[model samples]
Target: MQLKNKKVLVTGAEGFIGSHLVERLVELGAEVTAFTLYNSFNSWGWLDTLDEKYKKHMEVFTGDARDENSVRKAVEDKDIVFHLAALIAIPYSYYAPASYVDTNVKGTLNVLQACRDFMIEKMIHTSTSEVYGTAKYVPIDEEHPLQGQSPYSASKIAADMMAESYYRSFKTPVAIMRPFNTYGPRQSARAVIPTIISQILSGAKEIQLGSLLPTRDFNYVKDTVEGFIQVAENDKTIGTIMNIGTGKEISIGHLTEKIIGLIGRDVKISCQEERLRPEKSEVNRLCACNKKVSEITNWKPKYTLDEGLKETIDWIEKNIHYFKSDIYNV
Candidate 1:
């Protein structure tokens, strides 16, 4: 399907992946509506960081996703929807599991319901590798058994099932686009990439981190964004779940060493207790099965881990002031 001149709605347009997605949609000449979580400051989150020209092209809709009226209004008259809004921090999810349920599960219900009602052409529902938990097997595929090791993953699992149900029960056009460990500029401190980058950017001699043994399949944010668009553009992906990832795994310990090398840091690594997840909750390893996505859509990761990390480091170096390196984010 062609994307140019189409009207698209991107929920979570103020977030790291969402913001880049909005910019990409704009570049592709799509008429974009940006759905951002409303705040007292009237801030648009990372979308506020975008240049005026690109930001001007977006119709910013400030609303809570859990509110059906707000979400329904945003869905009205949109040809396609990219549902990316969620409460994504796993540690924070442990504190407020109900919030994750309300936003991730209930909010996704709203999106699916709206699409069913309006018969939207495409709905790309975002999923995460976390739902697979610790990989029981290498290259976890779409058929891999989902293990909700945390509240965040549980909520996402609920959301994903909701999307699938709509397709099976009501024939809603939906694509489950699961991304594995996306990292890039504008990412929040709650994520490992930014946490390490922030500390290095702050010139800390001691780098605090959690369990460094967990492994992940990392995808560059730009590649992640492109994968989303490509999935949406293909009719063959409807009612299917696909993973976006580079089929490569890196341990956190090794990742930290790489970061230290890239940042030229001689810092001593310190394992902070608060930074660690429960052993049962930690995903010990994850390497994605990207064959499903490649078979249906022209989606592929375009950056090597080192290349992506270098770009992320450069961004953090310049935006060091935006981070609170003195405290643990979550």
Candidate 2:
């Protein structure tokens, strides 16, 4: 299960985490294919900014993951597939739930079918902490009940179930990698970390945010990517779901204050009504139990919250122009 000289296909490779994964895979000596959403601009999303040294080794295939034909073409001849393509914005999902189902659930089905047909060695399916909703208990484990509070989480739950069924029915070498809140460079402004950092760096005295009471277990992007690699290399991970996260939790209000302190800025926190999720849809708390991943693989979170926030702040400061802090990004 060594990745060296192996062929790997990463769907959504143009995204925040996917681009980083592609870079790491190249560094690991794997032949990489990046499946990006097609556009007339021919944009590779964040991958377009990757250094040539890493980008040169990656083959970019621009296609929609929702299309079975496109997914099959990308899966062909690949030893492993990392499925990450999806519509992830929670607010946007509320407005367009069908799109989320089409992209998240159906898109995943396309990839799973392609992997099954191609007989790929491994397919790492991405899951989210949102599926757990508001935790019924502290330090949620893989077996914790999945409550889809929002359309986005519901779609992901369906996708995860699809992967599980494929593994059981067809013996597809599928491993579900559930990552908690992952934050770092190239993350969209829709996410809380980027939203906070972008606003502060944009010279806003007031930060607009959703619920401040919700607690989340945040993991740095590098740590999450390593978790993916660890799952792929371990044959024992097949047909299992593993959680990747720092076992620590932070409230959004505390996280905002920490970011402000790191940037050495004084800011006012404003909870905008528009930014808030519906009462039932909002996941109030999430804490990961990394016991499964730690006991089974070498994956462990390396960066503390302060450390990761500092890095994210630095990146957002330098790329401040990329964000429109005045507008709430859906």
Candidate 3:
């Protein structure tokens, strides 16, 4: 559990959650190799925002997660691997479902294989509450049935099962952490929270969104990062899945109104047909049960909804140019 001096590999180190996790790992004193998706622009995504001093400690390697050779190279001498790379946008998945399968499922298989081959200490695979589909029951626990409401969620479900197989068949010391809706600064515009905030911050009087009645259990990015670390530290989490959430639900309509109030705006809410997910594909509700995670690891959420929203608003206002507020992101 002592992270100091340990070498860690973090796939998707350039993403919203992955970037935050990398920062935390650096603070924990872990020697980090950050696996970023290769791009001609040579951008590091949110990792570019990290302090120069912290960036010095992380070695960045850019390559595709689905590339077995690339993933194999990233795994070398790593004591732990946190695999977070995936095609996460549900709307895009309808157009490019194959990419999700290749990255979310096959990419995870590569990580598991390399971990076993290199004898890594553990592998933490990131899952999502979307795998639970529309919540059949409020406060979904680990025992709740998983129903993939979209191709994107289905791919993630496949990846979660793939990680479990590695633990059972190869004893690869894998843990699955399913996070509910995590939102914060540097989040992509494809996500609902960021989309609304970016538009409102850009001085829009009306916000376009999908279904407002769908409720979600939201977790702040920092709190979700802590949950990942706790799972990595606790031995009991091995071969098991844990939920990270605030244990409260908010309808998208209410959330938008709350943000409007926080930003001191009287924005009209508009439901865009193009923005809505397919009737069956839409997850109408999601509320997580975190009792199991709390029992196994000393982890708890630190941010309330209002507090997190304020922070998100501040970030979006400062970086309004980074967002295309006039267009629907996905």
Candidate 4:
């Protein structure tokens, strides 16, 4: 269970959480392989910006997760595999549901099959709170009904089910790690936190957003990554699904005000029609019941919302040029 010198492959290593996980794995002395989406620019996404010292401990693989051959090659000889690759933008999913099915469902099936064939010691498949849709009750647990209100959430539900099937039929050592509204530096502008921060940093006095009443359990990226490591290291987590969250909820409107206050900005928030989801498609509320993870492993969110937002704002302030605040990202 010790990660030191253990070979770990993280699919979607170019992404926000994946890049942070890759960096943490290297720091833990794990032999890391970063699986990134192939691009002509040979871009490693966020990995391209990692400190030079950490790069020595990492291997970068450029390939599509939808390709079985590539996933098989990446899974080979790995002690653990963290599957995080998927099309995660909710608005974009409405435009191209088929792409979500292909990348999220099909891509996850490829990863699970590869792990099963390779007999990898462990596989951590990523899940999201969006799969639960609008929570029917406060502090939604693992047993909550999954209502796919968006194509993105539906694709994730299918992927999660696929992982479960692999465990039942093929005995793949797979565990699902469902995180609730993860945010931090390196996150895409499609996410609300980044969208708000990018706009504020761009000197926008009026912030455009969707529904402001929807509540969410927001966890910092570092806490979510630690949850992955905790789940992978714990043998009891096999064939299990664990929620990684802070057990707290905040409305989007309040969250926006919090961010604005942190940034010391006077901003007016407006609901944008272009950013709103369909009536039934919108998840109005979500709050995680992280009891399973807390009891099964030593994982808990370490950052408060204020602390995390401060860090995110600081990072975005310095990297303002990377964001096109004037253009709606989705």
Candidates in order have lDDT scores of 0.93, 0.94, 0.93, 0.93
lDDT of 1 at 126: 99
Give the per-residue lDDT digits (tens) of candidate 1, residues 1-330. Answer: 888999999999999999999999999999999999999999999998999889888899999999999999999999999999999999999999999999999999999999889889999999999999888888899889999999999999999999999999999999999999999999989989999889988988888999988899999999999999999899999999999999999998899999999888788888999999988898899999999888888677889999999999989888888999989998
Clashes of 3: 0
lDDT of 3 by residue, 61-145 (tens): 9999999999999998899999999989999999999999999999999999999999999899999999999888878999999
- Candidate 1 clash pair list: none
The CA lDDT at 29 in model 2 is 97
lDDT of 2 by residue, 192-297 (tens): 9999999888889999999899999999999999999999999999999999988899999999998888888898999999999999999999999999999898
**Per-residue lDDT of 215 in model 4:** 97
Displacement of the residue 105 alpha carbon in candidate 4, Å: 0.8
User: Model 1 Cα displacement at 192 (Å)?
Assistant: 0.6
Alpha carbon lDDT of residue 271, candidate 3? 99
The true-versus-predicted C-alpha distance at residue 236 of model 3, in Å, is 1.5
Stretches of candidate 1 off by over 4 Å are none
Name the TM-score of candidate 3: 0.99
Give candidate 2 misplaced runs (Cα > 4 Å): none
